[model samples]
Target chain A: MRNLIWIGFWGLFVLHQDFWYWNDATLCFGFLPIGLAWHVGFSLACSLFWMAAMKFAWPEEIEAWAAESTER
Target chain B: MEYLSFYIVVGYLALLIVLGLVSKFYSRGTSADFFVVSRTVGPVLLLLSVFGTTMTGFALVGSTGKAYTSGIGVYGLMASWAGLMHSVVFFIVGIRLWAIGKKYGYLTQCEFFRERFASPALAYLLFVILVLLVIPYLLVGVISAGKFLQGATIGMFPDLFGLPPLVLPDGTERQHPLHGSIPPEWGGLLICLVVLFYVFVGGLRGAVWANAFQTVVFMVCGVLAFYLISQRLGGFARATEMVAISPFASNRLVREGNMTQLYFLSYGLIPLSVGMFPHLFQHWLTARSAKSFRLTVIGHPVFVMIVWLPCILIGVWGAAYLGPLATGQNPNMILGRMVKELVDSQILSGLVTAGVLAAIMSSLDSQFVCLGTMFTSDIVLRLSRRTYSDEQKIMLGRIFIVAVVAVTYGLSLLLKDVALVFDLGIWCFSGFAGLFPIVFAALYWRRTTKAGAIAATLAVAVSWSILFYRDMLSDKPPGSDELTLFGVLPVTAIFLLSVLAIVVVSLITSPPSANTLRKFFPDERLSRR
Candidate 1:
């Protein structure tokens, strides 16, 4: 499950970055150009993807080491 | 208004001095306390300092200027890429480095490479390359501070210096408007001295504390500046509409004409340089625990969005409102000019100028302290066979800090019109990114050999030097297409070559000894055996 999540996260990065919107002329919400608006959404999605990584993909042993060090 | 802004900047500097002096109370009078705050920094301070250090003057002044010229593609090239990749670095590289640093009591990036590769010479090689790259990065901050101050205090000291206006041989008088104000040289010197005083007084603790305070000031004032500028050109919607309807509207949306898809994608690699930054290594080690990294990783992206969104939008708006930037005028002055023109209140403008300077100084202090720490720990202590007292260590660090500040400030003055802040910054970051593959391999791949690390460093150095020379010779204007190979950034070529060198050399050479593998990869069950 964790590996799948990591793969999904990377996939999102590659997909968002493919430059598909390079020729698009549409503006989003009457202000941002379509390409930039896509990135703003992509940025928000990346934040969540990382949050999931923190919860699921964080190295457990590092946490254990940190805990032990603080206890000392 | 210019007088008011100058006073506000003075007040901000005074406040930083106070913070620096007060930080001494927390110092236990040891080199460890001075260098890394005895590794006791909490999550909030760590997040702020790390973010502040990464932002630099490039984010505020350079991004706005580039966006003014190149349009919204500036965000795609850097800010958006940084927003994601910076957090990834914090998670993958930062946490592991913190663990190793605490375990081994490593003080600098070179110290880690030295012990891991078991080659003292590798440490020296890495130090020289890192310092060479970092000095230009330091210069970016200094030059931007000088330029911003010169722009902010325009007309404040008109004709006071009595310097005659420059004239061309063709008999045209050069427009020398800001010549009478605090020149970039003097303003740059003032910023250097203030940053040096703080880092010299309280060391890393003072730097981290100042970063936290300055980060808050800049972010708040940055948003205010954005709002005021947009309101001045009509509301946000109307301002953007004006930009959208302009003939250059396509530039506002996409990278127009001759910009390749690959070149834009290659910028994603640049933020990975954060993994190899010596200052960031020092910052990572200061974490009280690995848990301190959690907040940094989770919140950094959002924080990046908050700071960058405003600056990027304002720059795009400047395309339509400000019109073509005057020929030979520095684009870095655009943000200051926008604040001066749009904001009515002198007090507000002063506050905003103070905020911008705060952002610049926050990064400057960290770089100063990190350079000093590396010099004392990596060079003086490691190379010397004799033991030194803590007082000696502290003294060496202070002396090196002063030396680095002097060198960088001198270069800033000498090369006042050398390059735009963004252009020079991209080159510096690219050099560091070229080195990132080695650091990544060192942490994750136990087979990484000492020879492999040496080869990777050499590959980056040779490639980066050639490209830098070519860039200097070409003397292309800012926002022009950088010399690229197959439409990809020069960094892509350097990074690929570096990784290839590391992998192929490590495969041919003897792998690291079992003892070394056991030490770095302590969690591996076989390594424990």
Candidate 2:
């Protein structure tokens, strides 16, 4: 799941830039929208993705750890 | 040189001092207050402050020097692109770091990383590397400001003090001195006074509030300087032609240039360490919402567009005029010389110089504040598990701040080879690039064990220590080819190798106890964070 989110983040980064400075890379393979709206939306997706990752990675870990420590 | 702009400089200086002192009352008040502005930095001001901090006078001076030599290579332009693109990561990873920091009440990136990775050892390692590498970046800005000061107040202060004549680059082969000779320390002292004034008072919060104003001052002044110099030297088209015709014997366009690739790619790696920076983590923590973090990044590209245009030209102009003159001088000083030569008035030169100082000092405070907090709070106090009164913690932090500045100041004076800094920085980040994956996993992947985090982090740290500065490990100075390899291959290899190592190790390792996950990612903590 972390890998998936990481992939998504890097993928978005690759798509956003106009790094086609060279003629060989001039293929206009547009992936996302242009301008501020696109920027805002893309960031939202990333934010959500990270939030979900945190929760998934440490599911109940906080509470469970707290309880165990208290018992000890 | 006209003396009218001296008023602008004086007014701006007064404003900077007033702004710093006033912010003491208004900026955040606690440890968290000092570090993260209570996570309540607003948009307009936050935008300005962040931009001001990101690009410094080095952008003004050194980049101009590169442009002066390289002509109008796109490398100069890439600063904005890199800066703007940095936001995309901020929008993505930034919110995660912020939310986590808020949840844990973490003051520094080290604390967050320690919690997330369940590896306090690795966190300490990171803190040290961050402080060390970031010092060079800070000093780059300081040195640039110093150069600007030495040039700007040449005539006016002579009568007032022991100032001397400047070797005007007026087709003269002679070297001259300014009012008394202003060295790097004196200029550094001025920069330190202004930056320390605000940062000590308001901390990051004050810096945040003041940066917005400084950002405007830096940018408008930078663009104005670029424009005046470009026109004085000849228009942009002719400037390009001069670059095309001159000794820029390389066939690469700025976009296609060899260094360009390194710069753009190196910039992309900036985000790799962004989640790990103490200052940025502070900003992330204070965020009202993940939305703020996202907005910071999304809004970044626009700032890139606005700031990069004028800045790239300064470099271009400097490259054209001073390419031959950059014998022993720092490439970054190209713009400073151009400014000194092109401007007619002492006042305008002084105002522009003040703006340059503002740019450099702005970059310095964030690092000073962030690193100081990390050293004092996370490493010293947290490691000792000593609960300090607020005043004590603040005092510890202040001492660390002075300590960091003093050491970095000494380095700026003693150490000349700055490229070593970028090398060390990349090396340090690469040491922990392995943790970046784990950080992502902690945010998302539930199966990630602390053991797995430890395994990959150690593997990469060891690997980076060897690979990142492998050339420096040798007896001989690195050849261009070897430097090029280090520039691209080794760092890239470490980044990739670390990710791979983490995945393999995590699969082999015992799963993190469910309890660990629960405490690390408690559902009830949603609104709390």
Candidate 3:
């Protein structure tokens, strides 16, 4: 399982290089050049938003984390 | 320029004082609130706070300076984000760390390490390293402010030494000319004072909140600076075209043996440093959730893309624009050089200058707080076993902050090279990178005994010690860099070596007591096997 996680995690690391090259000016969002900052920024924002929404929406995990809260 | 200099520095100081006082309302009650802001730091502020420290004058002034001098190569600093989050085992395996830290009431990295490893000697050793390493980081902030402020305010104070001829504040032809070709002692002192004021009054919480505020200033200002500069060059396309056409841009990474090795090695080295930087992880532990941790990290690559593109642009811009100076001498002055050449508004220049100083102070103050608190929480408290009153310890923390600042400033004063200045940050971070495996394994793996932890700590210490001895005994620069051998970015080598040592020793040694294992890994033990 740890090995699987390692593979999954670091595989993403390789993918990240594509996301984070010095210049990916070839990128085309429709007819426009989204520009490097906007392209990278909006994508990251959308991904984080979706993931966060999913986490908060999960009833069981929310309840469990709530139960664990302030116990310290 | 004189009036503008006074207004910028003085006005900014007053605003910070007021902001510091206003933040005092948040500082009331329990030391926890005072130190960690009740861990109420939200995502934006948390991001900013982390950026505040992480980006610093080094990122703004030093790295840009390097970019100006070194061609597009230093932009690799930005490409470094992919590895930054890889080092974030504390966020993943570190859910266990939060539980343990809360349970034991441990604060700072060394405190947690000492208790978990159950070794006093290890704790002391770690604390000394933390103190030594933090000095360089603090200097990044101090030295950057010195350079920027001096350049920005040069003619304002021309005849202080009873000399008749005043050196005009020229944006002399380097990459970041404001970065005093000579280290500016007074500017370092002034910047140090601003950092000391808030950090002294409010401690870590104050430092972090200010960092949070400053992060935005640096990031936005950074983007704006690049955007404006690129506009002049007709944006990145023209900029990259300019660099590609320039003769100075090296194909060294492709052709040279050392550069090839370094390019790959940097991925591992930088990841380890980012993973274990005590300041970055402190933010990780304070997060609202593990999912939040994940989401926050998603921003890193994007942030890297945003932040570094400009730097590479700036570096190449410097390489192309610097003309005669490109043959020899530092190119890191590109941003400052360009600012003088391109940015003309008095208010705009002042704001930009302030933003640059904020970047330095933000990073420096937090680093100081981290170093001070680490010493107080980890070393002092460990040796005394929490013998001192909380108040006494807080005082000790403040004193440590002041002491570390003085030492780092002294070093920056002594060493005036751009390579040396930037090297300080990398050197400290590399030392901490060696500790990451032990930190993560202790958090996640139940079989990771105290013996394993002890072995890991000692292994890293001795390994680095041998490297250090080699530095002293041998004439050649250590490690494998085309520029110089043993150039202090050996993250992959260190991580693999440490991981192998810990796993082998753990396998040979008695496993951790069940109680100890339970204390760390908890609910997952049943799920594991």
- lDDT for residue B158 in candidate 3, whole number 0-100: 38
TM-score between candidate 2 and the true structure = 0.78
User: Model 2, DockQ value?
Assistant: 0.09
Best by DockQ: 1
CAPRI-wise, candidate 3 is incorrect
Candidate 3 per-residue C-alpha lDDT over B1-529 given as tens digits, one digit per residue, 9 for 90 to 100: 5357458656776777666666766675455554556555666665566655566565666666655554343444345443245324433543444445545555677777665666677667766666666666676667767766766764554345122343457934333323222237877887777777787777767777787677666677778887777777776666556655566642211113212334544544554555567766565555454444444444554555555666555755666656546455545566767766766555556667777888778777777777777766666765674477666767788798888778877887876456456555655666677877887787666667667777777777777666654433346645633222354345555666788878888888888666565445546434455
| Shift in Å, residue B342, candidate 3 | 2.6
lDDT of 2 by residue, B203-318 (tens): 88777877778888877887787667767767655554554455542222244443444544654554465555556666666565554543456556556545554655566545
Range of the 10 consecutive residues with the lowest summed lDDT in candidate 1 chain B: B520-529
Restricted to chain B, the TM-score per model reads 0.95, 0.83, 0.84
- Model 1, B1-529: lDDT tens digits are 4477678778888999999999988788899888999999999999999999888866777778888877777777887788888888888889989988887788999988998999988999999999988888888888878877877776677666434678989998875776666888988999999999988989999999999989998898889899888788888778888887788543665665525577788889999999988998999999998888988988888888888888888888877777777788877777877876777667777877788888889888989999999888887887789998999899999999999999999888888887644477878889999999999999999889999999999999999888877775657768865677778888998999999999999999999987788777747633355
Name the docking class for model 1.
acceptable
The full ranking of all candidates by lDDT, starting with the best, is: 1, 2, 3
lDDT of residue B393 for candidate 3: 67
